[model samples]
Target: MNRERLFSQLVSHSGPFDIAIIGGGATGLGAAVDAASRGHSVVLIEQSDFAKGTSSRSTKLVHGGVRYLKQGNISLVLEALRERGLLCKNAPHLVHSLPFVIPSYHWWEGPFYGIGLKVYDTLAGQLGLEPSRYLSREEMMELLPTLETEGLDGGVVYHDGQFDDARLAIHLARTAVNNGAITLNHTRCTGLMKEKGHVIGVKAECVETGRQHEIRARCVINATGVFVDDVRRMDDAKTENIVAPSQGVHLVLPREFLPGESAIMIPKTDDGRVLFAVPWHGRVIIGTTDTPVEHASIEPRALPDEIEFLMTHAARYLTRDPRPCDVLSVFAGLRPLVAAKNAESTAALSRDHTILVSDSGLITITGGKWTTYRRMAEDVIDHAEMIGGIGVKHCVTHDLKIHGSATVLPKDDPLAVYGSDATEIRELTAKEPEWARKVHPKLDLTCAEVVFHTRHEMARTVGDVLARRSRSLLFDAQASMNAAPRVAAIMARELNWDAETIDHQVNRFQKLASGYILEG
Candidate 1:
């Protein structure tokens, strides 16, 4: 489908849409796709760029939570495993199986973990992904030579899926658009439009032009993740604080630091959290320290204590000590967990999502992981349809094909399609060689991708392109800073932005990126 034409159609057309979804993260985007594919007129609005929140800041793993199995949450694990397999099948290019090694120090450790993993595989059954296998010390060392071999008896190797979380969200958005959903990024929902006592639509501001628009829909879905309570407050003052925002931080180290093909899954850390050293986009991503967070923000900054915690835990199994100096980048994300009445810690909070329709009639869906977004969307739509009295057909997103997703790889792969750009990039290497190296070595990211982001993917600024569309900023901040001028120049030419506008874009990007650094 022509996205530009569809967007134009949405802007010109005015009526009560079947569904209007808030937030552009995985849940909202997935809901949009499901609703649109079912023949419902849908509009999705986000305050920031899509996946700019917790959705993008994931561990990038699409696996059954192994730790969940240890906690006897077998149902959650099985469901996640099924979804992981489905995602891998649906988006082969974006999602691929990643083998992980769980190193065991004691002789019994291997068998014990192996048995658990075997149970994990058994739970998945045919739906289960590739089974886990026991690997000897020699085999483990072969897979990951940098692993600390001292007292290492053996290891368990298992396969789990990995994906570009932002890319997947983008694909979901595109799919929704393809199925005729109006998705507006940089659109902020300021208030809920109430009729008598029922929520009928939303009052939103376009972040770009600061223009206000009233979107009328039969049902307004507040799938704003952690901000669910804030949205709910518009209708009822006594809306329970459903979400307990928990902070999870990750540290990015150079690939040379790990030097391995497979990731290492630390089941339990000393601090009562699971740790993972996953290979992601050419960098070693060691993370995730879960702590309580009171305030919720778009950009969640990682604390120094969190970084030190990760380094200390990772050091236990690694050959070399990973210090703060070795850290390339650090990021933090807030998980919108449902607050349990008797829960002691955030780790014990339920990952399962909850959907609530308030007395004033605002449908809110929150507290779920990236892996179950589709299912969450389905549930949200089902709830919205019932509340709105809209008789929508069954969901078709289960078998829907997302935009830019192909069941088969093209004959001209990444190298072939990007080779010429690689050469041109090499010719201009001195000016900005990393740009060329990333795409083709001879060519920087081809003009096509940039155009695609703006024209189709709803990228409004240079930061959107670098940070989300291409991910140049996350990998190499300095290089992204250096390449900003060139990218802005390209954007200015296409978007017809004046010099002042280009400068504003560049400055905004710099200021936003500055937050990633550890301040004294």
Candidate 2:
């Protein structure tokens, strides 16, 4: 999926493709893999870098919706649970099982949640990761040493799954490429190409070069997450908006806040939502306020009140109060909640996915969470094949391993983002010792990672390297800012950029990094 290969494929392909997919987030990339693996000719376009929006900003859990179970949404819970296990088996490098505990404040809380979680495990059937158990106060304290002890009772412990969302998206894109899917980033779909009021193809333009092309296809599928309505309107100007965006925010704190491997799940927050303090990338990720948003933006910022809400909630559960100064980075993402009439609030909206087929043959999929992206993709392809009159085949992605997921070998570097590909990266570092050096003094992100992702992972900007590829920006924005100059220099060398372009990259990265800083 190098720049040259992607560009060459885009220019050389001269056929009526079986399917054309818009958006390069989780669902779009997954559908590309699904269709291509099933022996269909497929092409996908992304306006910006892949996963630059909602897909990358997830809570990073691949769990069966335990909260959904509480609301008696058994079907959604069961489906998510099944996908959770499947993802763990398919992408063992990225998806791993995690133990979660619901700390209790009342005596009856233990039995109540413990029974509920047991039923959750039962729903998973053969796909269950682990069984649920009850943890005593002493045991809970041992796992969550920083938790507030005065009002604490025992806790209910259960198991779920977790992963790196952006990394998974990157791997999906690579997997799609391996399966013969034509994928291009920085390419925007301007409008739907129609013939006799049927969607025949798409009119796309490269955002970087302003070059436009008409990619004719037998069918067009829109998987644009929060922006599905925009594409739907292109197919039919009278299309009704189906997406109701809801904002969720997360804050990264020092790992000491959640020192153990087990994650703490607060089943009920003051705002009637759930809170989780999970350990990820050597840091603790802890708010997810469900505020209704009228619009969706790529780089959404956390509000001052949202930051205060998270801090106040943390103070209630933890012995140590993490001030705004303690926040390493804060980010916000919008969930594309499918609009339901009489749904009082966005929180009341279902997490289940919605797929709609317009009269003009546009298949748009939206409203699913990250845990169920694979199934959503499979469904999209199935619908597309039906509408386009292609010979549909069974999906192979349920068992297919993503790119660089084969090897189980371990690595010395903690920041080694690629699991099985660690050896290849290490070999590169041996040839160029400077590549092994950390870009910033305090960060373990090495120079080799910057070079590896730029040359292979379709990394075109400093933001892609530090933010998504290396995850430095998510951990510490100030440190990421410090590392930007070095990252930009290496990218300049790899992409053959001039001094002005390098400066521009650094400037843009710095602006993005600034948004992650929480107010003190």
Candidate 3:
């Protein structure tokens, strides 16, 4: 996970490559691993740090798209569920099942959802994930004691996998590197190189050193999430714009807001969107309003209107009304839905991915969720090999074991921690109290986890360490702001950065972290 070693590998492999992947998000990283594991020399370049885009801005769920099932996209749902199972098996440390409670208000609501959940369970029968169960009102009350019991009839509990999406991307990148793939972050692809109207390579600039380089390859794949269209337009002016950005936002509050082990899923809302109050990283995470966005940018700031929208809906089930001040942090992400000619609402747009081979021979892949990243990578690589005249190899990612997969705690172990509850902190503190005291003297995050971020997680900045690696920024942006100086010092000592560099990183992190906090 040494940044220098990774950069050295990329600089060493400047010759012609079997595959050159543009964009270092989940799909691109997955493709790199898939292709490189098959013995193909691979090079992956990103405009910013890895997983600095939508891949890190997800709801952090690896479940089958239940909404897709409602839309009767059975094939997509089944495919995603199967992939979720594979990810759970292959990366158990990063992907684990979380129980979700779907509250029912109407008399027939319970049976209606129960039947659908039964169908969902049937699809995932052999996948080894826990099946759905019906919870009586009393059981529901016991599970979610804070829920308002005014109109509750019963509930249906189902199991779905949850994960740290950015960490998963990091692990995929590490796995690719371990298998001989050269992956470089902070590397931007400026232009596509062509010979006789065919894309033969790419022109790139290193953001860190401002150095220019050209990577020659037989095939170039564009897996940039919302930015795929930009790369496509570079290849062919006539190429249609295929990405419509959809904005989704999440709010973080204290765990005392809904002290529970199970997540609450609000199925139907007046605004035609589903709401979820899930426990994550020792705090409660309530989210996600789907709004349309025209521009695609990292560190998307959540709007006040969107914040109010979520609070209005979430207040229905909570014991106390959650005010704007209760929100510890907020985040927004733009979804790259493949743009249809007359697309209306981004939510109605397709979640499925589209891979296009342009006239200039650039393969652009976009429009998929975190759960289906593996499948998206397979499809993109399959098309890349076909167009580049390179032989395709069978994907080994299904049975492939990611980092920490072998060391993941067993499911039946009594000491196993579930969800992002305080159990994780307690376990870490019990094992490494000195580390815990250094990172989070007030909270539960440990110094060991911070060290682990630099040693194994490739965390280069305070924002990267707290925001993505440790979930501190996601849960409590203010706490992360307070911890930034200390984290910067630790990173400086470990990464060999000087005082000036540490101060620069701290200022940058503050600017980024401040955007997530609501100001009067």
> Against the true structure, whose TM-score is highest?
2
**Candidates ranked by TM-score:** 2, 3, 1
Cα lDDT tens digits for candidate 2, 4-118 = 7877787788888999999999989999999999999999999888898999888899988888988989889988988998998888888888899899889999999999998
lDDT of 3 by residue, 11-101 (tens): 7775688899999998899999889887888989988878888988888889897777888999998999999999998888778889999
User: For model 1, how does the per-residue alpha-carbon lDDT over 358-436 read when each residue is reduced to its tens digit?
Assistant: 8878899999899888788888998988898889689776776665555434323542222223233334444544433
Alpha carbon deviation, residue 358, candidate 2 (Å): 1.0
Error of 2 at 35 (Å): 0.5
TM-score of 2: 0.98
TM-score versus the correct structure, for each prediction? 0.92, 0.98, 0.93
Off by over 4 Å in 3: 410-436
* Top-scoring candidate (lDDT): 2
C-alpha lDDT of residue 96 in model 1: 77
Candidate 1's TM-score reads 0.92
- Residue 445's C-alpha lDDT in candidate 1? 54
Higher-lDDT candidate of 2 and 3? 2
RMSD of each: 3.9, 1.2, 3.4
Scored by Cα lDDT, where does model 2 land? 0.89
What's the ranking of the predictions by lDDT, best on top? 2, 3, 1
